[model samples]
Target: MNRLTFELRLVLRSRLSAAALLLLLLLSVLAVWSGMREVQRQRQTIERLAPLHERDVAALAARYPDSKDAGNPAYYTFYNTWDPPSGAAFLALGLRDVAPYVLRIRALGLQAQLYEGETFNPEVALPGRFDYAFVLIYLAPLFTIALLHDLVSAERQSGRLRLLLAMPDAGRLWRRRVGLRYALLFACLAVPACVGAALSASGIAATIVVLAVTAACLAFWTGLSLLVATRQWRSVTNATVLMGAWAMLTLVLPALANVALIRAIPVNQGVDLMLAQRQAVHGAWEIPRAETMRRFVAGHPEWKHQADVPGRFHWKWYFAFHQVGDESVAGAARAYRDGLVARQAWTGRLGWLLPGVGAQAVLHRLAGTDLPAQLAYQDAIVAFHREIRHFYYSYLFNDRPFGSADFARRPAFVPHAAAGMPGGTELFALFLLAGAVFAAGVWRLGRLRMHGGE
Candidate 1:
């Protein structure tokens, strides 16, 4: 205990250690604050849009009263669907900035409405958000290497390592030193997180998970640093090697994999589907009405009895051909979806080797902010788009009136839950990286011999 206390004091006295610890704490706090602000901004947008959406719907019904025809209502009316930020969304802010959380769909061709992009600055998104994920995955390890890389080697260089090892309770001495540094680093990270959670009013489970993951990450990094320090290498060499590894794992590998994944699976069929759907919907105007109704009734036998084609403009035929438009590109839609699924699967596979990528995948997956979740949103929109078509088809085919009252009673959209936190893949990857670093450090420390006191 006494020897460990001495080591802690020695570390505390170093100007570099103090500065590094302080900087980590500050950066963490900044990340937390930035993340919370982003979540709040999203919430505000959703809240503001509610009334505007209501007004838009009311205006559509007011302009095109029932008995007028379902065609006009279906043509001009827009349905608003939004995915609100989850309680824990502030922690990761995954994919939210790049994807549209608020979408305006219509009773027209569904494919056209589904792939619309959000209004975000691409330059801002290029660097990615400096949220909790960034701090934990990118910066925390650097601090760990900084504080622990010289754990034994610096003492040896200063001629105090021999004296320390010669102490009666060397294991006890080492434990105390490790504990002090670990606790100090953990506190620097945890304090900011606690404050952020409190500010966000995050759920108890979410806060606990965040803290647990943070601690686990710190423990892993500390173990690696301690192992490397055991090698008794020069502090400069240790720092260089560790930082290079961090860069490769966090930045290089993920970017390379992303490029390869995109090239391997080109999913931009989203645009092609939209264009085809537009042509099919608009081309229905030139087609014989009987042919469009034949296709619509074949797929939808329920509406066959009510099918009727009116002169000039007909809602039944208009909406029927829009359905035909969506169907026209079904093959491309499936291919696009398959491509996305492939990318997601490969990313999950990549997580096995890279802890940073692994952690990112887990966080976004848990947060329901991943690509799969985005695709799921599209699926929901497709279903709702179907319901919309059904609603219009009833009024058009059966010659029923789409009154303002009916408009208020239309089927509304229900959002799915956010995908939740890190899984075993991340835990396993973290273990592997830490284990390798520890082995190297141990070998270096074992080869080392020490002299006297500072």
Candidate 2:
């Protein structure tokens, strides 16, 4: 035990180890800080919009005091719905940056509002956020390579391996050195993660999950490094190969696979739905008023009391066309949703082979910020649209007053839990892949021959 402690001191005392560890720690801290700042910015934006929305609603209510007609108020007033970031959102901002978190929708065609994306600099989003997930999945392996790629090779080159192995505790010596390096690497990575979780007030369950994932990722990196080191190649050669492998695994494969997936599953149907809704709503003007009422009454029999189209401008007719437009594209909307679900499902399956994407899938799924999570938000919007339509339709169809009092009765938007996440399967696949790689590296390490001559 004393020898092991001394070995750890020796390894950590080296300028190279100290510097590399420091750099890793610094990057991790920077990443967490950036992520938290981004989250705070989004929260502030959402909070700041509240008074604006309230004032807008108040002004419209004052302008149109006629409570009997909801049509004018619905036309002029826009209700804003925002999905605030979850407590664990900072760890992996997920699709929050690219997608619209705050959306304003009116009683007009909801299809137009549903698919409208937020204005974001694609270049900023392209590189991805510098969050804890990015650090763990992309940079952690490089640190492992830096520290362990020359573990055994350097000793052999220094004429120390033969003598060291001849000692009575040779196996113990190798374990001690490798274990010490592994622990140092773990601390350098895990400490920042702990600190970030504490500062973010992230849930205990999420923190534990993050830490376990961190350990698994480090284990994979450590095993890969020792496997390469066992080749007895030059230290420079080992580093070059490991880095090349890192690039291929982390960047190349995911990009290529994403391209292939996009090509395979085209989800441009969302745009088509929006276009169709616009056409239907505008086309209602050219058609007879009774025709629109006939169509709306077919879906909503309860509106039979107000089905009379008196050859005049009626809010009921206008709203009927709007609901019909949404119904017209319902099939296309489902197809669009299925396309996204398939994409997420396949991405989860990739976790079986690609550790980076695999772990990423797990992290975002837990945080409820993945593409599916975004879709879930969209689904919430759809449900809320139905409520908004119904709330306004009551006043329009039943001739109920929609004054300042009714504005208070307006249906509030509620976000639901993201359902049917693929984490358990993803976790299972990740461990299977990890086991396969660890086994192969173990076999290769055991078979390594040290001498130059066969």
Candidate 3:
């Protein structure tokens, strides 16, 4: 304990180590605060939209109060669907910054409405958000390298490494130093995250998971740093090698893999589905009304008895064609979604090899801000759209009137429940990689020579 305390004091006395630790702590706190602020802003936007949406629906109801056909209300009224952030979302904004969390959908061809673009500055989003995950994944490793790269090189350069190694229980001594430094570094990153979790109401299990991931990531970097440090090389060389490795692991490799994955797994089905649905919907205007109804009734046999088109612009026929349009592109929509899920799945598999990507996958999945979460939201919207169809079809098929009283019965959108924890395969892969690297580092350190000259 005394020796550990002395080593701790020594680290604290070093201006570089002390400054690096302080800077990391400050950056972590700042990142957490930034994430919290952004999440609060999103929540505020959702809250503010509630009344506005209500008013908008009320206005539409007033405009179509006396409509005898259900199509007027169905076609005119737009329901709002949104995906609320999970409690841990502030820690990692993920695709939420780029994707739409709130969307307006109607009882029309859902494919056309599902992919509406939002207005955002690409330049700003290009660099990604300043969040806790960014700090932990990208910046924390740099700090780790800075502190550990010179662990033995500096002592050797100062002509003290030989004397230190000559002491009794030198292996134990080095272990204490490395362990203390690792704990401090992990603490520097995890403390702010824990506080942020508390502030954001992130659950205890999630907080523990975040802390564990932090430790695992730090362990990987620390192991790599020590492996480089114990080599017969200068401190500058160690720093350069470690930094290059960092860039390759965190930035270059992931970018290349992403491009390769995209090429290998084509997801352009989204655009194809959209175009197909648009063609199906617009082409209905040119098709005979009886043909459209025939297709619609083929899928919805329950309404076959009410498939008669009495006029040129009957609501039942109009809605029937729209339904037919959606059905027309069902295969395309399924393919698009499968493509997206494939991309996400492959990315998760890649996490086994890339710690940076692995950490991101875990964090974003836990936060419910990944591609799967977005797809789940779309699924909810589809379910609610089904409800809308049922409600309107009741009035349209039976030739019942749609009035203000019926308008009040319009279904309000409810966001889907939060996705559970990240996938097990990714987490297992991360732990395996971290353990192997750390073990290698420990073994290399154990074999480290104590000579003053390389």
The model with the greater lDDT, 1 or 3, is 3
Q: Report clash pairs, candidate 3.
A: none
Candidate numbers sorted by TM-score from highest down: 3, 2, 1
Best by lDDT: 3
Local accuracy of candidate 2 as per-residue lDDT tens digits, 1-454: 7897788687778788878888998989898888889989998999999899999888887888766688888887788888878767787888886888889998878887787673456687788788988999999899889888887788888887777766776656666676777788778777877887888777778777777777777777777777787786899999999998899889999989999999999786556778888888888899888888888889899998888967778887887898888877878888888998998888887777888998898888766788878877887887888888888887888787777787778878776663223357777777777666656655555453435201
Pairs in steric clash, model 2: 67-401, 67-402
Best by TM-score: 3
Pick out the ten consecutive residues of candidate 1 with the lowest summed lDDT.
Answer: 445-454
Summing lDDT over every window of 10 consecutive residues in candidate 2, give the lowest-scoring window. 445-454
lDDT of 1 by residue, 167-206 (tens): 7766566667667887888888888888887877666766
Which scores higher on lDDT, 2 or 3?
3
Runs with alpha carbons beyond 4 Å of true place in candidate 3: 118-121, 452-454
Residue 236's C-alpha lDDT in candidate 3? Answer: 99
> What's model 3's overall lDDT?
0.88
For residue 99, model 1's alpha carbon misses the true position, in angstroms, by 0.3
